[model samples]
Target: MANPNVKIWFFGGVNEIGGTKILIEDLGYDVCVFLDFGKSFSVEKQYYSYPNIPRSLDELIRINATPDASKMPVLQGLYTQSEITKLSQQKLLELEKSNQFKEEQESNIDAIVISHAHSDHYQYISLINRNIPIHISECGYNILKIRKWIERPSLTNNLFLLNVHTFKTGQSIHVGSLKIEPVHVDHSIPASYGFIIHTSGGTVVYTGDFRFHGHNPFLTYQFHDKILENEPIDVLLTEATHVTKSILSNEDEIGRKLQQAISATERLVIADFSDTDFDRFRSYYNTAKELGRSLVVTLRQSLILGALNICEGLATPNILKDETIKILIPKREDPTKPVTGERLSSWQKIYYQHLGAEVKGSVQSEDLWMPFKEMLAKMGTPPEEKLISHAQMLNKSREYVLCPSFNTIGDLQQVKPAAGSVYILSTSEPFDEEREIQFEKLLNWLELYGIPMLHVHVSGHVHP
Candidate 1:
């Protein structure tokens, strides 16, 4: 029988893709737990553009970029002290005028369970109160930690300070009277999971973004079998991302397609895909190896790979040890000088130092950046090696398969891809006006170099 005491609220992830925030309240136990407090790209784009973002937590809530704490007193104390202090006095007055103001107490929420590390699913976590423990998979936690180090510091990206608790698949987490069991599911990014919550009311299943058409379809199959074992579920929250789409492909097919495309090109081969999509990264890496071409990745991608390599059971290639893999360091302000710590960010300085390169500048104090310091310390000393410079990549264009994102596509101007060079768009097509504009810009860059572009992509979601 269904327990009437259990209630669910959909604060986001409805009628739009991403930005998933589901609140599961157990009235019988007098406790609440949130599932996946992620940002919605659609909602964010509605109000802000690049370089112009919400200045404070109050602004994010007011614009509906995140859940509105002012309207729901239950959410009143669920933000970090530093962030709440930044709320404008006018916003507080507005809350009081609407009879929605509540005294900020310790967080009432039991915990926030993250299903994955995708920005759409976990970006807003920085604004969450540190008192509220965040439960995530071990792989997801490591990915977020690395992202914090590489990304530029900002008000909305304080992920380093999160009070996190890591769990493995099948591990059960108890928050008040609720028991959450995270089960691994296949997705574009590693360490993705779905949750089966045993609440005071009933058993509810929430499927965070998942797909069965990737390298490990069996993982999603296992999740399905697990769901059947918990039959008579009172509620089921599942993703319907590709319900209307029919096109489908798998990792093996994509690998073969990539190899064929790379073999046909005699000159430079440029591949564009998500930085965190390790499955696609493997595909490109394997193709490069088979074709006797080095797989060149951006500094950010190299750092992500290095992070993944440290996590147990991921089997990621070590960039420092892999002879066929090369790190493409971006050009510094002084084009004449060799890459050094003085020209890099705090995290980049550490990475370059690890590569045995001469670092001239002082690193940032650990007092302000403990997480980056601690994470690097955990990684230990890697094999010292030299990074490939932009000039080196340009001269040896035919010897490498360059993987650059839209942000780094400008590098093509320096490489000036020789004739017969090809660009592969191994990612999804634009889903919105902003992305459409970016897509056009990418096309312009390829056209400028007279490089032929090919689309070879398999989605991270299953087809209907």
Candidate 2:
């Protein structure tokens, strides 16, 4: 027999920013595994934008979720039985079936090792076969669990039932013929990791997504010394997200600019940024506390911050315990009726209870804003500091920093910020025409509200 050979095929994340899927097969052991089988954000617009999706595996393959696995016999179990039936009906099932096909195999994959919990890197995990053992860091898995709760539409409780094999950093996981060692790497999101694989053929190092100037550059250095420098690598796969251009600023520099903007503005300052970025969250949280103002956050953001605070190594501030942290429970946007617990879904109810937020008829009503105003009063501001109207917020523009996103632009219209108040654009700018249209619309909204928009952003990716 020929010497054992290793064949590597990439199903995604080739020439794009995300949607990475790497398949490795050790012919000697007749076993195969995957590294970061994630969905791509780029190809999505080619098919569906929102509220539209492929109903079955055949449709998904046509749109490119599991593109290469369709023809591979060994990976047939990755799809659900009903999905396989649909594939068979379409004559798209090319895998040779054995007599024992009546019983689904234990797994289509020997194992799956995930790099991080970013949707682009791990969104399609639900499509994987149920029996396959998923190996990920404890921190990464916890992030996924929190996401399942916060982002109810993307995933469900079914994810919690998967065969998860949690590991720690620097620990090795042994599958049939592959030994995968997860190495810690820093990224915009927490619990991101890279991998060092030992195969019969040679050693392989896969950098999922990394940056050196994050909250911890030392973690990236640890990865370099422990895996890259020590191991003799035959195949090295790295991400070049920022290879074409230089990074604008490190995390600290971005924080400094943000502090300046916050200090100069004396009104209700609103900063729009990526919620998954905990480092940014820290910076804003600290600035809000330092300036003696409560940082107002949305329900989803509060949950994410609460989760990260409990999670180890992140060093996040406990929003629940901190008097400076205030949860801004926006009124449910149904113009036809008053917002109440009866109108909320089960998840929304649980989320509200978790935050210990008081329910009122509407967030726009004085009753809803009274609690925060009370807190402000106790902080030495007078009862006259209460925000009753957009005019009031404008007059007291120096009191708070409201964190909002593009999707919640409707709320801004309700708040009707004063003319001098600033809108800090802390997230990435439009990279595509579709996003550019949205950006133009956002500017129009701010212009209509008479608020000046300021651009101060930092890239999520590292400078290569």
lDDT leader: 1
In terms of TM-score, how similar is model 1 to the real structure?
0.91
* Tens-digit lDDT string for candidate 2 (1-464): 12348888788898887889888887766668889878777787677665775466566678775664658876767654433332321121122212122325555578788888777777777666756788887767766655544343322112423568888786889987678888888888777888888887888888889988877878778888877564678788899777888865788887788888888876778988777778888888878777876676766666565556555776446655565665555443321222366665444554443344434323223332232333322223212111122343345568677876437577587677777788988887888877888789889989987888887776767785
Colliding residue pairs in candidate 2: 19-39, 266-397, 266-398, 267-397, 267-398
Q: CA shift at 274, candidate 1, in angstroms?
A: 0.8
lDDT of each model, Cα atoms only?
A: 0.78, 0.67
lDDT of 1: 0.78
Scanning candidate 1 in windows of ten residues, the lowest lDDT window is: 88-97
Candidate 1 structure quality by residue, lDDT tens digits, 1-464: 26778889888899889899999889888879999988878888999897897788778888787877767867767777654344432332243335543434587788999999998889888788767889998878888878766765455665744678999886899997789989988999888899998888789999898888898888888888998998878899999888899776788999999989999977889998888888888889888888889988877877676677667666556655676787776665233354555566766776766665666787655344455556655555545343777667767777889988547467676556777899998889999999899888878988877888899998987678
**TM-score of model 2 relative to the true fold?**
0.83
